[model samples]
Target: MAPYPPPQEAATSTLAERVGKGPDQNPNDTITTSPNCNPNGQESPTGKKTQASPTAIPEIQWYYGKHESRIAYWLLLSGAKHFGYYPRGTFNPFPITSALRRMENEILQCLSLAPGSRVLDLGCGEGHISRYIAREGSFPLVLGLDITASHLAKARRAISGDVLRGFLRQGQVEVRLGDYHDLFTSGTGIKMGEWDGVTAVETLAHAVDTKLAFSEVYRALKPGGRFCFNDYRIGIPDDVVRNESDGEVDEKELSPQQRKTLKAWRWVMRTGGMKGSEYSYAGTYERLLKEAGFVDVKVVDLSENMRPMARWFWILSLLPYAFAKLFRLEKAFYNSVSMYEQYVEWGGWAYCQWSATKPAT
Candidate 1:
């Protein structure tokens, strides 16, 4: 076999393989998972060689001092029933805030499956989504997979997170540490005609490679199984530059420089741990999904039904991550969160939620 890569090779790291890339998130909760580490091209549980770097290009986003981001987030939101920015930490605040409870209800509705369905929640933080599926009175088996040990750790310590109010609906819920990329490469994880459903919310943006990510999802599902989730594409607007075709600009269709800048945003995320990729106009997303092997792809503007609260939530959502390391506000972190929350409650912000699905056999 080929020699393994170096320590910086994220895909092969003891930590990275154990869970995919760590999720940089915190809204109302957390997500976690675990697994072995092997940097080789294949998933050799054997743990025998060196690691291989997943990419030739540097990543755009990374978990820059993420541990600090997590601490700042939880400390700031203590005792709050709902975050209004990021529900349970993995879902979105935009759709929820925009449509009141409708967005949440709609997503839950979209996820409603017949009994005995096998479901996978990628980037399942704190197991809330899986918990919901468990209580959902539908899926008999619900699995939430995430790449953050802290998230899995917190889920394991559900008693402490207090934030993970999972359906408490029985042992139907399981949180595991694994990467979607590896999950795709490992055919056993998905039986050819086995899965009934697979759902990912607000997570595709975090994948190291979106195109390959969809292909993995496609391989995991049975024909006709719905691969539904809200994800971001490549085009988003800056303060300037508007497209003539539509009221807004399509960054995907922009000039080369704009395209490079757009892609660079993702680069910053890989290195800095911030995400600006995955977010683009719905149409552009539709095109990419088809190119990725996802058929019958559709984009829904759940944001139309979104509330101002979600906008408010995402508007200041970056605070914890942005300031966590710079200020190392460890001592006054709680105070900072409190002030931010108060500001959001006083002001309002919202974001869009786009849901899609994979074609069944």
Candidate 2:
């Protein structure tokens, strides 16, 4: 509407540098850069606007790359690749790593998966969860799939020495470059109905198309297989509903500051590969799973249980926020920090444990 502001070349490049090169590093060559681009933001010889290009947004991708790189680096630093589950809170007397181990064990218990079952860890970063499943649950074959090569490399390194038995007898776990949205469509080299269980941890929210992703998961699982994961659920305040129509929520009704906050929040989620446009609400996952041919779909609210960890994140976000504001990279910084704060404070989002079963014939 405002002429879409000339490509912020300097800022864009800086942002890209901060994260890593996006899917494409050359910023000026974007679909929007063409002179013949039409009113609908599409390139055409006729110069007639039809619809926007379906290409990924470079800024968002760059932001996510950096965000993921940061996560990988942090995992490298922690030597554990996770912020260990702090169900009670970070200040508790129990050790963090032990809690993390316990959390994984608890999740596996819920899955009721037998040893030697094949588990696919969707959106698996560093294969921490997959490794845990393999080592603890004795799930001989575990596959971790992620879009980031670096993260997958980290996962591979982390699970390198594992020597359990099953589909992949040489290694207890494996890592692959795959995206949840294209698990079935793209050539993942994994067969349908091959997995006994699939686990996604704080990952499904990042799905660009929740329905498509769910459907793909459905197709990937064996009959009687279980899909389990935890992720954020939408939880909006009463005053926040400015506009709601056509399967979209308009935040124009929010205050100017609130609108800016929402913008920053989305940028952060986008960096994590989460699509706010396609994100599901509290009860939506159950319905979507049902549509995807899943049965016994259950979405459990674990918001209170996850708050302690959220509190820790809130406390940790301070320095980054200051650094961004200091360097005037506030917009890029907002992509993650404030969005997390909203989850921690305003009930903007709820963390939930989800499980669904593919029924046996």
Candidate 3:
């Protein structure tokens, strides 16, 4: 296998140039450097100028840093943070490892990149799917990026183990601290049109600015490159009304039950560091992708394939949720709350996979 290429030199292009936008377009958009590095920037070992790391959001840090959250994810999902995909007509959700791999395989199929493709995995938790793509899909290099420090630490250790065991060549897969919103910025070391494929698994919903995030991904991909991801979306109720000027939901129009369910759902999203309103409806994603200059967009509802696993989570979380509620410790058990609200109580959430292509021309 070919060795991983050296990091790209920091480009001199302005944000508008990098994103193929005119100076007046998106004038309000801003670039933020990452956290934990020098404010003045420093030179990398590769002689590239590296800037500060992306700022880590407090909610993400709090949620992933909790011992209970870590234990629950490991115990239930076996360290795969995303939902599993069961075969159609299958009632059982056990043997979760297989189902998780199936979901990964589905992503690989959606990507359909040639061997030796350069790939980027955005919001990669623990680098499981990144490594899977490198190993099973024969991608020469897979760079996994995430904002959470704890998740990156685990991902690095797992990559190290894979290398030591001779299951993967050194540097076939790597994890870095990065924010999806800052992809084309200097500090992140990601250049425009740098990747043949880019993927986000349950990732983009956490983006603070969905439009900026989508634009960054579109800017970072090579022409004709594919972007695919699976994420959560809320079902908009028929009676809900939207503001005509900005198209935002009108809270006053929500029925009492709808409001309550939305509150619970938003709380769950906040625990994962996402603004629920931004990703509430499926149409939002499709419209945003088109606005970002992507073409051939497709969305598939995978909710049925994920129902068994959701049901399992709802079942397993019941006891712990009751205990947490009794003690008023629901914050520590937010995952349980997510399961209860998503599967059992509200049932307005859907699992969806989306794919889009950068226009070849």
Candidate 4:
């Protein structure tokens, strides 16, 4: 383990630039949250850290806010541990499983793991990508960290029973409870600059403190360690969903159909806990990585390639949405439908694959 340099005594302007108040700000400070963001989950009414008994575990608002936890639960119930990357119609000759596996392979290639290299799978829900890394022998040591207990449980169970069990026994695979915001912090038990590379795989969205998460990743990686991820983020402004540039939105120029789509889009974002107020655009992600000392930042828009998957989800969700609408119980269903439709349309949001690296001395 290596010690981090002392915190720079800079102005807190960068922290307040996005979410108001720095990470070290008092609990009493007015911290802006997304729509429907749970106040109880942020801090106690007395502005003190909320604690729970052994029998009661306190929930942390990661990602799309409170509704995010529900989405995880539904994913588990649907037997889905992670989202799969799909090729566009041009590249759809192979089956989806093949395409997804191919995507996984590409991610590993981007990571470029060396022999006996240590890797961290940040926000590794159920360890899907982590298991793939072990099974593929991409790294001799792989650490999967997630805040979700149930996901970690499943990740451990799945890894132990799979053929990759040898890797687990060999000390090559381990899953631990950790918040991305606190990746290199002392309490996380992860060594700073210990990893050869890190893969987030659509995980940074769950970060409560995006700046801190990026800074921690920059700190945790060995110099020249690569960081890569696939993420869906805000591509356009909420008020003006179409014809946008530089994160600006104009309400007066939107078409009627666009406005309808925009409304549904907002619902999906709000319920998904995205809220668009933070660094939702692809540019914002690249900027953060650079600000955190990552170099050679690359952002590839994969929205079109993801259309096939979006279409599949839209079809699959129809049955449930229909049933829920018929019964007047379409709260979550409506959101799901909206999400799938917006994905198919590929507007107001973007699915992107990004890679960057810590500068080698």
Most TM-score-accurate candidate: 3
Candidate 2: where are CA atoms >4 Å away?
Answer: 1-61, 67-83, 89-94, 163-169, 237-246, 250-264, 276-278, 332-336, 343-346
Say which prediction, candidate 1 or candidate 4, comes out ahead on TM-score. Answer: 4
TM-score of each: 0.57, 0.71, 0.81, 0.70
lDDT by residue for model 4 (80-134), tens: 3444556455534236555455566667878877755778888777776786765
Ten-residue stretch with the least lDDT total in model 2: 1-10
lDDT of 3 by residue, 99-135 (tens): 8988988899999899878789998889889988887
Clashes of each: 44, 5, 5, 1
lDDT of 1 by residue, 204-267 (tens): 5555445445656666676767677764333344333364222245554576755654544433
How displaced is residue 149 in candidate 1, in Å? 1.1
Model 1 accuracy (lDDT, Cα): 0.46
Off by over 4 Å in 4: 1-80, 90-96, 163-169, 237-262, 275-279, 323-328
**Residue 39 error, candidate 1, Å:** 5.3
Ranking by lDDT: 3, 4, 2, 1
- 1 or 3, greater by lDDT: 3
Better of 3 and 4 by TM-score: 3
RMSD of each: 12.9, 13.1, 9.1, 11.3
